[model samples]
Target chain A: MTKELLEGNFAMAEAAVRAGCEAYFGYPITPQTEILEWMSHRMPELKRTFLQAESEVAAINMVYGAACTGTRVMSSSSSPGVSLMMEGLSYIAGTEVPVVLIDVVRGGPGLGNIAPAQSDYNQLNHGGGHGDYHQIVLAPASVQEAIDMTVLAFELAEKYRNIVVVMADGSVGQMMEPAELPEMRPVTRIQGDWPVTGNVGRPPRVLTSIYIDPPAEEVYNHKILNKWYDIQANEIRYKEYYLDDADFVVVGFGTAGRIALTSVRAARAEGIKVGLLRPITTSPFPFSQLDELSKRAQGMLVVEMNTGQMLDDVRLAAKGRLPVEFYGRPGGMMPFPDDILGEIRRLAHTPLTTEGDPRKRWMDRVRTGELMLR
Target chain B: MQTEIVFAGFGGQGALFAGQIMAFTGMDAGLAVTWMPSYGPEMRGGTANCQVIISDEEIGSPLTRTPLAAVIMNLPSLDKFEDRIAPGGVMIVNSSLVNRQPTRTDVDWLMIPAQEIAESLGNRRLLNMVMLGALLQKLPVISIEALEKGLDVHLPERHRKFLKPNIEAIRQGAAFARGELTVEATPGANGHEPEVIPPTSV
Candidate 1:
């Protein structure tokens, strides 16, 4: 319908509304308070339900309860808050309930400052709560993407039959940009046909993330793995900005990519053909895209607000074929454009460290075009 | 070309709403626009601000430390943002709310006694409309007709009838600009100064 300049967090809420989110239960957190506020205001207008959940734990349990009823449910919090919801997250994944959780990352092992951090990467992508299950994690770099990804999370969560977490940093939650509000069309209701809720249907559906025996466990894990593989195949998304002709590239996602985008423009002004590879989907990691660009880019620099979560992932994916360096400011301090430019400048003069490190074997294969998305 | 602006002031003033009008007006004029308010803890009874960016091309960043112009509802915002404004940028201020004068002569500054002008109009709630008028005076950002249309579009149906006084408030506010207007023109709208009109009678 109409386009509004919505904040990233509000865009997430609007996207949820567009995706036919039946109910919302969340607490207020920095960079993400707007979602709670927006949903509170908007839901009533549309005759939907929104609750100010008592605590992160209560909120997530509420989401689990709603998802058990097969409703499109959502819960959002920052890193520390997400930690509290891990028990529920594990339950949601274990029960194989289709739901969406948003972790707007902020600095932290604790009550880290309200700044954005990507440290939750390992936690989210690798099963933060516990178990062998992985949440379909989608990272959005801009407000517009926040809307799109939140809507997509519903589709992916249902397709893969798992919890989909839209992970972002403070900057992503805070940035404001021109976003097209979805036409105020009604969302068709979602029904999980696994037959879990009742016997009234044609067949009974038992939804559970449990394995009864070795063969069953193998089968279950195999099934989960297959779904993941398909996600990798069909949904690995990223953007290539000025990368076709470039000497160096900056790899980042969420807010880090946004700050770096402005710098990339400046770096271009200085006659440095530095491009950007922004991951629109962080979980499927978009390794294949980075691998392809490595052939053309002389080198690459991975920038993140965390110490090295995404950087390690990039290094692992790049296989050292290109000189991959990183600059990080963990715990709530966002990297300014100048810091990014400095990293770009430093990488320009340094030679690729292709040998003798911990990842030497991996890099060896990467340089010879042998590294892959294993 | 596109223009970006921010109107900052203490909470309870018209800064956020003023920014909203400017943005909606731009949108009504068919320009791509974004109006974002300060989110989180900062928007309490503390300072509140809204950012409005109107661009013919797609706008990249929504939060900018620098803007093509600014409308400062008070002194702190002026102190906080004046140095960063584009050198030749325009500034519209509520002189009565701010106690200090700007030291820079490079940029254009319109020191309108906005709150006073609003009070002189029959209601103090028109504080934002005055700032809106002053903003319109400085930049051809939105046509007067477009702004009135925008307010009509955004205000609730019950409030739409208040448009005339709001327009008058904005007009008087625009005229309150130091050189752009004379103080007498605003204070003379009714039988007396709107600043002393008293809320109950309005």
Candidate 2:
């Protein structure tokens, strides 16, 4: 149980291997290439499958094929690379096969720079592919969490026969910290009558996403929806800090959340009663918790590394019961703790309102060149 | 207590490695630590930097806008991070490369000719270790013994041959910082054999 200094990408890759990931197929992408590099050697050493496909599209399709065998399989990519795998992901979702994906998100819209960002929050949390489907998104704020979440992703993906996306920004993927990895588990394949392993002694079982009959597709979609409800009820995960006797709350996920914790602590030192709610599971987000907090707290500040994508979720969860303010840095820029602390100071002193759009208010501040001073 | 330090230099100057060594040393001393590097399409000559935070409590942000200390190894880094160090903090500058004097008067500035010291030790790459040695002298968040132990545990096997020289470079830098040795009076300059230090205990 000795802890060693481990980069987030390498730690998550090793965690997947220890979690008995039977196959890995991925294309090289910045801030996450280390995962593929680690898997290329470790997978072969364990006699597991590791293939670097020509592109992310091919890699995800390979993941789809391997996942159908009822074995643990995954792929890792940055923002643009993950975008290329959307069609394959939708197909996998339709076919009801479990797959673990790690999105080490970078700046995006298209061909963006490879720097830390939470811009992919909307793409990963809300369905990236064209479908009425939801992927279980786990947002890790630190290296240790990245390792733990990777292992949990495999378990969750298999448990519900759904996709689990370990959504981490480039900062988490590129940083290093002391973390103890999990013990290696023996590779176990599903023993059920679901795998397409040649069907030696029984009738051939077929798996495909193509449902020509409209009613049959509707039935399958309903089944997926019901499963999502079960996930929503059971898998909502988050972390809280200094919520007791607080007047205001800050809600963020992944790196943004951790950064806000520093700001929250500073604000507390300044005699401001503030706390933080950091979501670990962004899909089955802690909406109920936010609702409960909104009832008690005076107002909420939503922080992010993107232009208020998760802010939408926070507003929905708050139900406009209290005023919600927004602060964020778009593209590849990360918000320093001081920047967030400034926002928290404003939230503490100003008279908040729920009437205007929080994003618009934030935009006004940005347009006035107020944030540049920090 | 918490200490945030920035290691800023050109890409090949080993700033990232020095920060990693500090992080490992802190972690070995049972403190929570994080090392975050500024990564992108930067090449060997491009600017590179990393922030290392060592704290008794769980760390919130791995980065800082105002570091408690900074190890500046080049002019550009000094230009970029000079004012970022908090008042009354420590700034270790590699005087061998940076020619200008620091404008700030609030922080303690230790200008060590790290490149000259490393070259005297027969390897220019040891400049990072030299600067780190100076940092430990001024701000002993972790002891020099622990740093030596960190070198033992974290230094790759391929670079093991330079261990003795690296340690010597660190000691020389520390001695210079402590005012016991001057930049013009390093060991090799006085025809004295460099002392052979004992191996670190595991």
Candidate 3:
């Protein structure tokens, strides 16, 4: 086990190389530019394909084109750049191409700043493109998990013949940590009958998404939905900390989830039965787990860097059996551990107050020196 | 055990590099480590800072709001980060540039003429290594020998010749920090006395 210190972007690039990814197509965007920068030299030196596309749209199309040949291809971008790639991603999903896409999230709406945020949760989990399709979204909180999930993204993409998305915040992309990289796998071009081959041995295979017949389109939609159902049943991943016996459960994902663990620990030190549930896969979200855990908790708090984007899912998972509360710091801001602890204390002690802004409550406590962990 | 440190200075002063070296040394020693810099397209001469966290267990967050130690190379960095150090924490300030004394009396402050010592050694770029040596003297989070090995891996091949000088500068720094090598006050040294406080266990 060789351990080396690596940043998030470099780790993802190394994982892609180790996974025998054949091609990379991407455009430069803040927080995610390092992924493209690292691959620019590595892919060439490894004798693999790499391209710096003119724009994110062109990059996703390049990924689509490479995937059509049954090659392992990937592209990455931040919020604005990802927004531009939705069209091509929709086309790729409609065509059922197995491609990997990474979104190093930043504050969004339009061309947001290069700071970490979970604002892209909606765009990634819910289909951003116009189609009845879903991308398998995996969210990693740490650099090590980033490397592990990135390698898994390729295998899952290949297994389901669908696009896979690795959703990470800018914090994970920028931070450096000691990571145990997976060993390199032998590069082998996938020779399958599904992809279009230039006429040497088999019949022509046309990979298209346009279904002129309504009945055929409906059948295709059902096929895709069945695949999604299978993924939900078999691919849902999550980690539970101190939830064996807890009256309050805190739910989050990605960076927000990682920070919540600190708050949960501090709350536990104070004898509060507060636990954490971090969802690893956001699309085939661990709804069943959340539903089961909800029955054992007094209430649930959904923390995020966005304005409650993932709260709806938690509510649906609870099915009105438990009260769901949300606390968020939107616009690329992050809440400290003490901030979440204060909220946990408030929620565990009293009902949701309707006094001042819930978002500003923690900041106000900090001003008065009341926001403390212990 | 866990230690949170902030390295701050001008962009060209290599605070980021020092932080990376600390993180690398911690990782090589089989400790969990994280290094984060003040990123976003800033060129040389602008303010720069990097946060490093070394712990024996998994780290929850990479960013540190209150650092247990700080290495400040310039006056601006000191003025900005001096008070952010935790109570009973330690700080190493480059006495060659900073003139004012720290206002916080609760922390231990080590004033080392790192840049001057490096210049006297015929290389001004080894200032960060000198500061690193002094840091090791105070905390010994990682050994100097391990740091030397880290340089072997982290230093660029073209600049490998400076490894010896860098190690020498670090030794001089450790000596000055230990009061084995006394430094006379130069211009801008402000005749500030180096304050030493017993190390606090984290």
Per-prediction TM-score to the true structure, in the order listed? 0.83, 0.96, 0.92
Local lDDT at A136 for model 2: 98
| Cα lDDT of model 2 by residue, A1-374, tens digit | 89999999999999999999999999999989999999999999999999999999999999999989998999999999999999999999999999999999999789988999999998999869987888999999999999999999999999999999999989999999999999999999966767788977799998899999999999999999999999999999999999998999999999999999999999999999999999999998888999899999999999999999999999998998999999998898888999999989999898889998999989988899876735
Q: Write the per-residue lDDT of candidate 1 for residues A1-374, one digit (tens) a residue.
A: 66665668878988898788888999998868888999998888888889998899999999888787767778888888899999888878777778898888887888877767888888898768876677788888777788888988988887777889999877678755557866555645566565246678376666665666778877766777777788888988887788878889998887778668767876888888899998888888888888887877788887777766777778777777877776666677666566577667766765666454423433454458553311
Query: How do the candidates rank by TM-score, highest first?
Result: 2, 3, 1
| Model 3: CA > 4 A from native | A352-374, B43-45, B188-202
Per residue, candidate 1 scores C-alpha lDDT tens digits across B1-202 of: 6687988877777677677777767766777666656654566556777778887754434555557788887667888889877788888877766766777798888777776677677777787788878778778777777887888777656777778888898777767653666653243332332132221110
The count of backbone overlaps in candidate 3 is 0
Candidate 1 or 2, higher lDDT?
2
Residue pairs with backbone overlap in model 1: A194-A205, A195-A205, B119-B194, B119-B195, B120-B194, B120-B195
Model 1 alpha-carbon miss at residue B27, Å: 2.9
B1-202 per-residue lDDT for model 2 (tens digits):
8899999887777788899999999999999999999887763447788999999998999899999999998888999999899999999998777767689999999888887788888877888999999999999999888899889888889878878887887788898899887665243432232222222211
Q: Write down the DockQ of candidate 1.
A: 0.19
- Separate DockQ for every predicted complex: 0.19, 0.76, 0.55
Candidate 2 displacement at residue A151 in angstroms: 0.1
TM-score of each model's B chain? 0.86, 0.89, 0.89
